[model samples]
Target: MSPLLDTLSNAVGAAHVLTHDDPGADLSAWEQDWRQRARGRALAVVRPGSTAEVAAVVRACAAAGVSIVPQGGNTGLVVGSVPDGSGTQVVLSLTRMNKVRAIDAANLTITVDAGCVLQAVQDAAEQAGFLFPLSLAAEGSCTIGGNLATNAGGTQVLRYGNARELCLGLEVVTAQGEVWHGLSGLRKDNTGYDLRDLFVGSEGTLGVITAATMKLYPLPAAQLTAWAAVPSLDAAVQLLGLAHQHLGAGLTGFEVMGQFALSLVAKHFPQQRVPLWDEHPYCVLLENSDNESEEHARAQFERLLETAFENGVVSDAVVAENLQQAHALWHIRESIPLAQAEEGLNIKHDISIPVSKIPAFCAETDALLQHEVPGVRLVNFGHLGDGNLHYNVQAPEGGDAKAFLRTMEERVNTLVFDAVARYDGSISAEHGVGSLKVDKLPGYKDPVALGLMRAVKQALDPHNTLNPGRVLSA
Candidate 1:
């Protein structure tokens, strides 16, 4: 046996280590990303059961000068969790360590192993009469480690914040195979470095996050959801201002969808039938949650909508009659991405701009795209409340989509990213700079910030043994 393989087998047992010969060893699901953009060969896929085991595996890899790619559920969109083309890198899968370490309902905190599925964590918190608000459509399959690695943002980010905000502490295994136990439920800790923050969004480049302690909130007593048709993106932003004035932070969700985006959902899922038939230029899916009763929440939402209508911000609106109806509305919003994917051959750009700049950004960018890439189909939608938009572009019908993408994908990306830059916004909104965006990081990211990132990476993983060529390229 190879010395490195022998050492890994000794560290985490032989059964947990799978080589190329094992059945399902290189299953496309694990080997490839969600978008099928990255698929790489690995020396072996290792499953370590505990922090100590992870540390030992890391130490062995470090000693052998082998790169380790920490993988969770492999649901990442940025090609972060998969191995590189090198046949020497090891795939460290955390699936075996899935467990709920602790749930302190009294403290409004739940400590869990990093491998636990996000939905499982939410279920545990709900079972304890609390709510873990880090939600995403991939919650059923995406692991907490992957979510923390990317600092995922979902529907609730408008209120509860993203993964970085929802997390209180983390137990990280650094590059040298040393475990740093910073998992505490304390709300306020004025520590020197705030190491927890560093590993949360490090994308497995700085360290391997073994476990985390996350904050929870009281389950909402009553929740309200609305599907409103707005005259334009400008009106949607204005309605958002009215919503803030009326509902304030009670507005837990404020999502926007363009006509084509919603139409795709309806077209893909004909069984659901389009809820609102109005062909408005834009739509806003807003959710309001409260500790008060259902009636109170409903009344508050009605007041906000009424005021919005009076001000001509909202063209039309509908309040979900029941929980099933609310889910139906949200399902439509969540289904847009899948619907787009099902349709095929589209370039997705997840960028963010200031809330105020969204209307102009959309108008200018849309105009530019139409002008430059003539006959381009645009699907514009995302968390407008939080300023992140999934600005995706599709080829004109019957125009050799793949060839168009091949010729124009880079140019489209340049246009979107340049617009993002022009508005002083981020090229990447919620997703981190995984291997997918490593090259683009140099141009859009500030040089000093990039330098500091490299410095920290050097300090943490001097050998570049953990997830090399990921977030901050070596």
Candidate 2:
């Protein structure tokens, strides 16, 4: 065994460390991603069960001058979890540390180890008669550590906020093997610099997030789901304003999808029929919640729809009558990614602009792409409430997906990112600047901001040992 592997085995345990040549015990499901970007090999996969064990593993790696890649559920959209083919880095898998240490329902907080699966946390919250409202497509498998690492945003972000906002404190293990225990559930602590926020979205580059205390919300007593067909993106935006004004705090989610994107879902998932007008140009999935009767929530949703229709914002509408029907309506929205995957490989982008600028951004970018790359198939959809969109472009029919991707990836990214910058939007919204977007960051991010990121990274991980060559390249 290599000296480094032997040291890691001794630090954690012999059984906790699997050597590089052990074939890794089949990580196909864990290794692959929703996007199928690329994969890499690790020198060893270490499963540490506690914060102390994680610190020990990190100390060992730091002493050996070997790199460590911190991983959670491995469901990240970018290739952040997977190592490069060099096989020199150790994959520090935190799955074994999955545990809910404490749930202070009265305090409205839950302290959990980073390895705990998101769904498990949600289940724990539900059992406590509360709601951990971080909803995402990959919640079943994605881990809280990964969620915080990426600062994930989802449908509930409009109401509950993103992972960063939901987090109150964190327990991080720095590169030097020391645990920085900041897991305070206190809501008001003007103690000092907000160190927790730095590591929350650092993507494991600055330090290893061992555990966290996340905020919880009161469970909603009622939920209303509606599907509305809008004549145009402008109408969809107008509808959103109306809902906000009328529904106020009850308005939770507002998702807008172009007709073409919805058509793909209908085509791929035939079981999920179109929810609104068959030939509408755009569709909006609106969700509302109230702490009162379901009938009251439904009535409020109906009022919003009625106002939208009267104002010429909504051409048609359908309100879900039951939970099953509500899920079916949401299924159409969630199935967009699955449907796109079934169709073919495409250049995908996660971008966000001002909520009001979305209509113009979509219109201008669509025209530019069509004019630049003839026959480009566009699939655009996402949370309009937060101004983030998944802008994807599939290769023309009969074109080679892989070959097209290889030749046009850079050019395509430039097109989308340039347009995003023009609108003062971000190239990365929910999906982070994992290894994929690290190269493109410097151009988009301010020099001062980038420099400060580098400085923080240097202060926490001077040796560039933790998740090296990711987020901020070495």
Candidate 3:
């Protein structure tokens, strides 16, 4: 055994460490990512059951100059969890540390171990008669640690905000093997630099987030869902403004999808029939919640639709009658990605611009992409309220997806990112820049911001032992 592996074995015990040649184990799933585009080999996979064990493992890795990749659930899209194929790194799996340390319902907060699955936290909040509203399609499998690391944003961000806003505190294990116990339930703290914010979106480059204290909200008494067919992207944006103007903070989600994307879902998922008057170019899914009666909420949604219809903003609309019906509407919206996946391979970009510029951004980018790549299928859909668009390009008919991807990945990225830059948008909206986008970040990010990030990294991780080659390349 290598000296580093020997030292790790001593620190966390032999059972917690798996060697590179351990064919007896099935680690293929961990080796791949959610997108299956990034794959890597690791020297060993280490599972630590406690924060102390994590600290010890990091100390050992730092001493041996071995890079450590902190992974939770391995459900990330950016290949941040998996190390490079060089097989010189250790995969520190945090799955075994899943636990809810405490829940203070009165304080509207919950402190949970980083390995805790997001759904588990949601269930815990429900058991206490509260709501942990940070939701995503992958909540069932994605861990809270990964959520915090990426500063995850979801549908409800229009109301509750992103993971960073939802988080009140964090318990992180630093690169120097020191456990920073910053977990507090207080809603106000102005001592110094917001260290929690630093590690939340660091993608495991600064530290390993062991646990977090996240804010909770009161469970809304009623939810109203409406699917509206807008005449255009501009109309969709206008309707969103109307929703916010009338609904105020009650408006929870505003998701938009192009007709082509919805058609794919209807084709793939036969049960979810398309519910628009005609094949409109754009559709918006609007969700609202209130403490009053469902009848009142429904009436408010109907009023908005009525106003939109009269003003020619909405071409057609359908409001769900009950909770089950509302879920069905949401099902179609959530199934877009899966249906697209079944269609074929494509380049997926989660880019975001200011909410005001979304329409122009979409119109111009769609034209540019179609012009550049002949017969390209555009699947543009995402949280319109937050301006995050999953602009994906499907291969041409009967074309070899792998061959097309190999030929056009960089070209496609350049086109899309260039458009985002022109619109003052972000290359990565919700997802963090893992190993996949590290090389492309410099061109998009300001040099001063990048320099500050590097300084913070060096200050916290002088040895560059935690998640090396991710987020920033030294």
* Rank ordering of all candidates by lDDT, starting from the highest: 3, 1, 2
What stretches of model 1 exceed 4 Å from their correct place? none
Candidate lDDT values, in order: 0.89, 0.89, 0.90
Q: Which candidate number maximizes lDDT?
A: 3
Per-residue C-alpha lDDT of model 2 across residues 1-474, encoded as one tens digit per residue: 988888888878888887645654765444455567877777888888899989999998999888888999998987788777777888889988889999997899999999999999999999999999999988898999999999999898888888999999999999999999999998899988999999988889988999999999899999889999999999999999999998899999999988778888888888778776368988999999999889889888888888998999999898888999999988889888888889888888999999999999989999888887788888888999989899989887788888888998898889889999999999999989888999999989999998988998898899999988788877
**What would the per-residue lDDT of candidate 3 be over residues 184-291, giving only the tens digit for each residue?**
887789999889889999999999999999998888889999999998889988999899987889999999998888988888888888687247898999998987
lDDT tens per residue, model 1, 1-474: 799999999999999888887766655556788888778888888999999999999999999999999999998878898888777989999988889999887888999999999999999999989988887789899999999999999998999999999999999999999989889999899858788888878899989999999999999998889999999999999998988888877899999999988888888888777665447988999998888889888889989999998999998899998999999888888899899987788998889899999999989999999999888889999999999999999888778878987899889999989989999999888877788888889889999999999999999988899998887766
Worst lDDT 10-window in candidate 1: 22-31
Q: Tell me the TM-score of each prediction against the true structure.
A: 0.98, 0.97, 0.98
Model 3 RMSD in Å is: 1.3
Error of 3 at 423 (Å): 0.7
Off by over 4 Å in 2: 27-34
Candidate 3, residue 213: lDDT:
97
